[model samples]
Target: PAGDGKVTTPTGVTASKVTSGAVVLNWQPSTLTTGDGPIAYKVWSNGQLVATSMGTSVAVSSLLPGQNYTFSVQGYSGTHASAQSAPVSTTTAAAPAQKPVRSAYFDQWGIYENAYYPKNVDTSGAAGKLDVIHYAFANIDPTKLTCFEAVKASDSANESNPNAGDGAGDAYADYQSDYNSGTSVDGSADTWEQPLKGNFNQLRQLKAKYPNLRFTISIGGWTYSKYFSDAAATDASRKTFVSSCIDMFLKGNLPTGVAGDASGGAASAAGIFDGVDIDWEYPGSAGGHTGNHYSPADKQNYTLLLKEFRTQLDALGAAQGKRYILSAALPSGQDKIAQLETDKIGAYLDYADVMSYDMHGSWDAKGPTNHQDPLHDSPADPTTPIAPGTRKYNVDTTLAAYTTGLPEYGIPGGFPANKIVLGIPFYWRGWTGVPAGSNYGLYQSATGPTAAKPLSQEAGLAAWKELNPPAAQTHWDPVTESSWFYDGTNFWTGDTPQAVQARGAYAKSKGLGGLFAFSLENDDASGTMLNSMDGSLR
Candidate 1:
């Protein structure tokens, strides 16, 4: 044996089992004895000493995620040291993106005037990250009491909507209207011969591009829920409703009379729709669109309706060899959710994304400005004068209403957290004519909602891309966890990027499924709100 007290160098140094923050290294033990006790191994990362081990393998911990590291191993026995093993390099894995599903509503009407299209989802890069895209406002046939597709031009000044019970929807936007190459998902113009030419075809293109994408035809939104009560009224009604929906959306049976060169009929839109999202504004509440039908039986019938959809969807899935999604756009208002059998309806849903925004809006026309989407209730809120001292009109209370029901509120606390997705709004809720108070307009009185926006934008309402109140006028409330704007006259409330990241953090912390927005059109041209959501929900 060599008298030099050094041990022979270890060979075959290797790095494996790498993660975002750690990596494991292994090597053949030094074969030659140093003529001193035993040998221990030293591990180095990026040329810095990091770990020591008695065995041939050592694991390096506390490394940065997605970092590139170069590691080497050395063995020593007593005062003697072996030459370093050959180094190996590796890049730590990137951290997992948001574990919860990220979903959003695609307002079909956004195409008419907002000029948003299914192609926007692709161009904005939302398609690559989204879990579900709920195509909003598929109508319920009032006469047949079933799901159907049709379009009727809207009348803003009219509250007594003639289309309230007429199975009215923008079918022209759904699959009938043509998308030119510039506005189409694949840069190809939709032709007359194509059975499906509009948003449905563009969605199909987006779907093909993103394998994980799911498109659900959302039936019974705020405007179209007028006939939901009739559709979900009884066992027979539920069966008829669920079957018609499955056939119309999942099975792609477009009504033949949609006004476009696109001839519509059986199987015209098959494979474009993954499932259905039930958005009956309220099962037994009076707060929906003015004439929406409601009955006390809606609570039980809501659960039964979900059950019927689940059963029928499962049966169809068995035949098609694919699982179809079934979700509901849940209400956030305590009173509205109270009308639902939260404990029961959850059993049949793949997801129940809470519409957590719109807690307060211009509807309270008289005064007392409010933050529409508070993550938590503010002690500073003036709502006590409006109603109870309780702070029940925020995001936390809404999520808890389902995932961990509030017993005091009659909500049963046991729905699975991972199945629930939180909703974020991409629009600002505002009001005007406020008296400049000590807090500007934090909760001051206002004569009414703001002036009506042009292009038919709702009065006192603005999309995320529209509002840019001055920095001097902006305010953030940490107690309520919200941000707002007030220039001593016009008061506005909405989700800033910081507020959005906070909500994403909230979703992860609560073990919830993910986050969604009320609309795709409300996002800034850069998709600021949507991008913030995608990056932070992890």
Candidate 2:
């Protein structure tokens, strides 16, 4: 078909399998002619004008499968059309289907209390809906066996002298004595020789009641973090500690000498833990005295520990014919950015829960009775220019610290979608000396600071409820998205329905695993805050 006008096709269309019903078409650009001003091209399929193009190539979609179609291109200038290019034939193939979405949840020490058990532990009725349960082992001390005895003694002593200056000290001493005694608190039997007993017992109970529930054992909190460095310092110690932990966690047995009794240890541990959770307050740095004080070797060794743990767990699962999960609790402050080896650790973990609370409050200079975790900007800093007193502990900053700082340190998935679990606080912090109507103020006590009114000075969920009832006064902080009330002399702060919903919404927007409140006991009796959280998440 010789014609005066020139014909051209889009450049770089190589023949390759894309999908069953679609085929890509490409060709080279046409040589510019002096008289042909801005040539236009027309694409044809089986002699039908499928597309008219001023430039090169287009993806042809929605074609009949197994049907052969002839494609050709023709150039045009104004009203005149050129001869068609050589016809190219292609057959349509079938397209591949998309993958289905999977769901997951974070259990932040949820299984610690057996809400589904005999005492009707949880008044909120959230146990049935929970998919994962986090079982905590925070008070375990490797140096002692009678820890429970000490705890019981401490409780008894505190009750004896309510006004004693060292009442708290007496309680701590009793706790240590119990740990050393290796005897149960009730004196009925021997204390558990392994670390996984109490938590595992609760987990076993929960799983028996809810067959579909999963359990993860979280280790290392603010108080027990001091031992991590010492345990991970040398290869021998690391191996010993890691081996003992896994043996106890996976098989319910203590590793060698560490266990007082070895015969039934493996079987007991295997019956409880479905996964291991690492809650190292901070690695490669010191936190509490219990922390091991990690060094440069810790950066690499931590990764090694996770890898070995994963490998061992996988092997155990294959042996037991069941799958096990691994996860960690990451630190929230910006200062922890440089300490962790993110990529290696992230590779081994199924997910990580960031403890996003304790961000601000009396810890800071000015007192503001607000939500410890806010979704809005920091209202206190005018130069930074954020929503005044908005949710200061919002998802934005938390996500940024993890995704940006972590990956920069060779840690992958810092911004991993659906792999992060946002933490919600069941309590609130309040301050005193706050100016009235100034959007921020202090939370004072009723007896003018000197009175032993209600509870201790420290703000806790239980204390707040007793001191300030909803009927007495309405507590509200628009900027911080929190609430508080004053009983004439004392100012108090506490969690409410509004704050809980805000936390759930933030988790939803970020595609996170879910939301986890610190302790279920902190919620109101009718499950007001818990119900609000569940509804918001759903």
Candidate 3:
């Protein structure tokens, strides 16, 4: 031991990221010649040794929030401890508001043809307080196996020139059209010459006004999920599909011809979206669209696909210097849930958007006139056969199934409760020509819709706008915590404001992530349903 032989101290110590109860400390490793061994680091915080690491950075957690702390790192060679590195002082952030996520699925098609544009949304109500907005649909090309196509819809109004299918491009509604209104989030009109225009541009402006709102492009819905099984059939195919999605949404790679014109070019819509959502209807079974490819292998491949998506998204996020989210819209039916490897697949997703509403609908061969989106089970009979369209199906059961019924492959049991987000319906499933009774034909045998409601254009289905029954006609089922209305011949069943509040409260209580409705456009212009959801969380 020589007089000038004091171990050289580490330097440049800093706490780069400080959260409520964690800090990531970084410091230059020590450079010294001591008789001991290899160099190691001892992270000291407030005079207490918190961690030991061989690397330059260490994450320290369980620290008190809203408190000042000084951190220093000491280099150790063998048994000799060098003088501590320069201390870095930092104050932890206050504990964040533990508010559950409140999300809404916005349908892009509703903007133009339905006359329910973004400008018509009541920002003061539920629409304004949303945490996440999932823009409905980016379809996978069944043939090309690359790119997400826009919502190409037909103009049913023009009989002579019904818009022909043109490669699924809907730029005019997405980010092209100018919807000038007093309720513009920025109180400004689109220049009409901007590269990006419609609801996308409107969404960008809205996000600027409300910085915390997150928007994700939801890929796949009932009508457009014909290619998911094939896309995820093999690792190579999955990678191809995933890369294509990232390029289209995250990298803003627009398709040539139709969609390309709207996107302007690559990366044009890059920053507009925070992530991509997979809405692969039913993975191992039939989804919303006909001719969907499916197989028993889909169960396993589904998990692999999700893992790949997570891997690619994480890589992209790392390269882009930001976090990206990966989520999925999952089926609510227990039978359908069993078909997929959900316990494993869910691990890669941010949350499982359980389509808890459509548990029962007119798609059934026949129905007992049950509510489509009940909050809880009403019939207590265990032996009662719970048909696809029966009263036994409820939101509570769906939530429980995702969080506890299925074991996570040695993860004790059941899906992680926190990763489950209860999905509520924003519309009603209607049945016509029902026999009127004391319960007004609820749970009674009836002939399903004789014809589709003209406005909704879907047989046995009606949106909130098309199926608003009188207040006196509505009835509440206490056991199930659901509401239904039967105007003698027409039986409509869906969520009421009270039922939505009940479900939201249930989600909060169960430690679930949050709630996401099937759609925002289905709510009233006053944002009544959205407000009801807001009030429940409050």
Candidate 4:
């Protein structure tokens, strides 16, 4: 008599009831030849001969846990060999656990000299929520104390001056003192300010308090961006400037005794500055101080410069067994995109902070000051049109600028969703010329037509309540998805707690990292704005 000539086990042979040292393999029986007696079978483990079997079921013992093993069976037709079934392998399940996610941001002027300490850090009572805080080092007087003290003194002097000093006087004085002064403490030489006094030292304290928090020194902003063009014009200058910056930042040798730690100074420096952020305002555009005459080489050379920085920092980190980060704050316009080779630059960057605010303002001709980012509608409505190209400000425009503006950048990790902190203005914009009954009225500055006029939080809230009280009036702008109180004369452009809630929802929907208010002091003392942001974002 001949045994079955073919072995026909079901596809996907699986093992069930598997334990630490045993497994149960199950499969349908194979067909036997018409004249052959019930075909005998032999089950092999890992394709090796293991044991002969007469039934379809088999329980293998002494198997290792979590080990993958293949199994197959063979049939016999008398003395002739039959085909073997396909092999099946089983794998053990891995233990369950959650992976960690990293977060960072491009904070606007986070390390101001006088205001960068824990005293100003409200923390919303939720300290340690941030993993990385990128301080935009705008207006650093390497020759003078950081710009914070100067700005504070300027503010005080202006408040006391006959004409309040205005903008020109303070700016000129600061420029002269910062650049012309040869004094050691004038901030000419690079040195760490007294402990917890200057921005850098305050940052050191912040890092110490929040062990996981990291800091980055960002260079460049709207006013002082002119130097970047000059520095990048020549290879020698670029190398020299970048090298000096790295050395001053890392070694603190220029102005001795300013560094946070003297013992293991190199390690201390490494600990304080995890990276550097380049905030070249409008690299290729005419706007800001970066100069309007950059050639095509500037764009290409910018990438090379960043690459050089990354290479040098990485070399240092490797030598010291520590890791350093690299990032940049990109312009918020399409014209400036050419200044950076986004694709090449993205590879070397840890994150890119996109300035999504300041897209519209009094710079445009209009009566109502709309939201910086409107969720819907154009700046000017078609029905009661006031100006051309004026619409509600919203994230859609910002996202479009980054996506279509720098498509080649590939923007590793989806436009830095978490790193893409939304810029919220603590102050509001206003104007005259609106109708008496318009909903946009709140308070107007009689002394000045510019948005620089200071508006107190209490006064602003009181005026809004008196004019368009929260109960009677819900400051709603369908066009901007923002609310404002029109007190008949001035058109106040400020955000409410409700508007902030909507912004938080929008940020979450867009997968943004967090929200950053322009100036912390402008918020209500009770911290209505900050608390709202914390609740929504945290």
- On residues 1-538, what C-alpha lDDT tens digit does candidate 2 reach at each position? 3546443333343433434544455566554444544554555565445434333443343344566666776665544456677777777654344211111222222222322221122224655555455554433334421011112211211323322211111111111111211222111221333222232343343443444445665665554454565566666666666666665555544332222222122233343556777776677765323323557676677777677668777776554434577877776654453466654576788777777766655544344344455555544533222233222244465576566543333333344646777666655554555445443233321222222333333333233233435654645555556555554433445556766676677778767767665555444446565566677677
- Per-candidate local distance difference test: 0.76, 0.48, 0.69, 0.47
Whose TM-score is greatest here? Answer: 1
Point out the higher-scoring one by TM-score: 2 or 3: 3
lDDT of 1 by residue, 1-538 (tens): 1224367877888874676655667789875452435455566555444545445654454345677778777766544567777779988787666467889999887887788888888888888778789988777777898877666754534556645435456778877787887998767776665456678777766754564577888987777787888888889988988999888877776777665444456555665677789998888988887777899999998889999999998887655434578999989887787788877877899988888888888889876888888888777677752122244588778777777787666777567888888888888888898887877788888888887665336787888777855678888888877888887789988888888898899888888899898888888667889999998775
Q: TM-score for each prediction?
A: 0.79, 0.59, 0.75, 0.58
The alpha-carbon lDDT assigned to residue 80 of candidate 3 equals 59
What ranking of all candidate models by TM-score puts the best one first?
1, 3, 2, 4
Query: Which residue window of length 10 is worst by lDDT in model 4?
Result: 165-174
- Candidate 2 stretches with Cα past 4 Å from truth are 1-123, 138-199, 254-266, 286-297, 363-370, 381-394, 405-413, 440-494
So what's the TM-score on candidate 3? 0.75
Clashes of 2: 55
Badly placed stretches (over 4 Å) of model 3 are 1-95, 122-124, 154-167, 178-185, 191-193, 259-263, 380-392, 406-413
Q: lDDT per residue, candidate 3, 1-538, as tens digits?
A: 1113445677898877787655677777776664544555666665555444434665554455687778788776544567887789998888787677788888888864466665555353654688778888777776776655555663332323312222465666766566565535456655543344567656655544444566788887765566778888888999999998887776655553454443344334545567778888778785444456788898888889889989998886654334577888888766677676646776798887888887666665256677777676665423254444332456765665566663422122257888888887888987777887657777766676636766577777777766776899998888778888888888888888888888888888889888888788787767777888877877
Error (Å) of candidate 3 at residue 312 is: 1.6
lDDT per residue for candidate 4 within 3-100, as digits (tens), equals: 23443443445675454434456666666445544444455664344333333444443234466667776664334445667777775333234212
Stretches of model 1 off by over 4 angstroms after superposition: 1-98, 156-165, 260-262, 385-391
**lDDT ranking, best first:** 1, 3, 2, 4
Q: lDDT of model 2 at residue 49?
A: 50
Model 3 clash number: 6
